[model samples]
Target: MMKSSATHYGSIAQFFHWCTAILVLVAFMYGPGGPEHRVYSPVHEFDRRLHETLGLSVCALTFVRLLWRTIYTRPEVPPASRLMVAMATAVQWMLYLLLLALPMTAVIGAWLEGHSVTLVAGWEIPPLFATSHDVGGAIASIHKWLGDAIMWLAGLHAFAALFHHVILKDEVLITMLPSWLTMGRARTGR
Candidate 1:
């Protein structure tokens, strides 16, 4: 049950998928948005640290997920248009790329701006790069844009899954659902 079968994703892959989604959402919520002064201000310190911690966790989990994907077989794609398949693959990779890039940009921008990368439990990573406020500001702006992009793309992904479940009446969404949930759905003829 830990490895994906031809018809469904494994429990492990499901766990990684849902957990990463939750972490990304929570991190986005905690992010201290606004100008640099406001973001690094003492008033937003806890939120900032929590956001960084979650972002870093997402980055690490993404790497593990990639490793898991390589080692385990994923469910075969259900019947769909070639365009749909291509879009799904593109979205998947974009999500992975965003997962890695978001945290890296945060760390790099903070370092370039001469700010410490603070995390939970008072852990801090001091600036490693030479101070370049202008460039750091630019990167930080991009990070914000990327954060918004991820949320929108994730929403689209969810919509596509729902489209498959309700409109297309396919197994695409069910394949990602927990076994118990899917079993209940089957029993109810839903």
Candidate 2:
């Protein structure tokens, strides 16, 4: 019999999922410590560029992932309590929205700051708006807070996945685990 839903996400989805996670973690670690300690120096500039590059990469990956999701069905996770399912669905959608909004905000902020955004290998993305320090600062603040929210959401997501895997002994978490890591038993029919 044919499966009703995917057993595990394909390689491309898994790749983007893990890569985005790592990039987000790195971005958080590199962001300004606090408002009082904000300093514009060479090192800070380098970090900002790196952060921008990663953010752009994330935006590209998110677009591709969204397109893929539109074309393909997601794997079916085992049933959970209604409350748990609803919460998980909400979190998932929020993550998706963040993935879309965060990078666009960063790009807009960069343009407002009179900085050119260079993609990997030095390809420049033309600015979409005129330079405005005040606007840039405001967008920067929003970007930072959104990033902080993502970090908290990621923690919650990881905790919930672990709970389903370890505490509930459900396939919810395993279904997303890479096949090699899960010893090829992660798949569930439909």
> Which digits, one per residue and each the tens of the lDDT, describe model 2 over residues 41-92?
5446666666777887788888887787787778885677899889999999
lDDT of model 2 at residue 50? Answer: 69
Badly placed stretches (over 4 Å) of model 1 are none
lDDT of each model, Cα atoms only?
0.95, 0.75
The per-prediction CA RMSD against the true structure, in angstroms, equals 0.8, 3.9
lDDT, candidate 1, residue 163? 97
Cα distance off (Å), candidate 2, residue 173: 0.8
Candidate 1: tens digits of C-alpha lDDT, residues 1-190: 8889999999999999999999999999999999999999999999999999999999999999999999999999998899999999999999999999999999999998999999998999999879999999999999999999999999999999999999999999999988988887778888
Instruction: Give the C-alpha miss distance for residue 54 in model 2, angstroms.
Output: 0.6
Candidate 1, residue 11: Cα displacement in angstroms equals: 0.9
Q: What TM-score does prediction 1 earn?
A: 0.98
Clashes of 1: 0
Worst 10 residues of 2 by lDDT: 32-41
